[model samples]
Target: MATGDEIWEALADFTEQCNNNKRLRKMQRDWTKILHFKAIDMDDSFTMKVVEGEIVKNDKGTVGTPDIIVETDSETMCDMFWGDINPTQKYLRGEIKVKGTQEDVMRIDVITAVIWPEV
Candidate 1:
């Protein structure tokens, strides 16, 4: 099993690569809703999809999948991940480099901000 840090690293890499993937970019650009999201913090990884406001596990991919439905404690979690920091800007400023959509990048920042209002 992968450690939490390892899982996080992989997710970051995976999303980054997925964002830059020409095919994925083209596909996501035409769609508005995400099918699912899987992510990992440390000890746990999960997958879940939104179905009429209920989150369910339909499939599995990476160990630390980005499913917000299964692992998250609340519905608001969908917007929670991005606000922690302006990771994209940080990356450009030599703080952190991410590998996902600009939308994904901004969402993470939004999550950060919501979670840590003091920061």
Candidate 2:
């Protein structure tokens, strides 16, 4: 199990990497979204807000209405954000659960693929 702090740190790093990537920015240029991530094995939830491809807010707790909600173990989340695991594979293996419109889900998957191409 990973601590909440670890997850937060990983999220921070993930956001930084995404924001720094030219291709990711171009791809997400028009994608504005609010996502809620819950750690199923722990009492922790995080919200990430993206606007014009930039992650404007990423912090503990749910901040607003979610366009997407994803649930998984804390460690898995940390691993995914740290580019240590492929989130799509985790979802396929039933390790991650996502509730959202098909478009939103696909968008998240695209983000993961771009961020962690080797994973």
Candidate maximizing TM-score: 2
At residue 75, what lDDT does model 2 achieve? 90
Residue 108 C-alpha lDDT in model 2:
90
Q: What local lDDT score does residue 23 receive in model 2, on the 0 to 100 scale?
A: 96
lDDT of 2 by residue, 1-119 (tens): 99999999999999999999899899999999999999999999999999998899897999999999999999999998898988988999999999999988998988889988888
* lDDT score for residue 14 of model 1: 40
For model 1, residues 3-112, the per-residue Cα lDDT tens digits are: 44444454454444444445444434433323343333333433333233222232334333342222332221222232333333454664343445666555444433
Score candidate 1 by lDDT: 0.38
**Candidate that scores best on lDDT:** 2
User: Model 2, which residues run further than 4 Å from truth?
Assistant: none
In order, candidate lDDTs are 0.38, 0.93
Model 1 stretches astray by more than 4 angstroms: 33-119
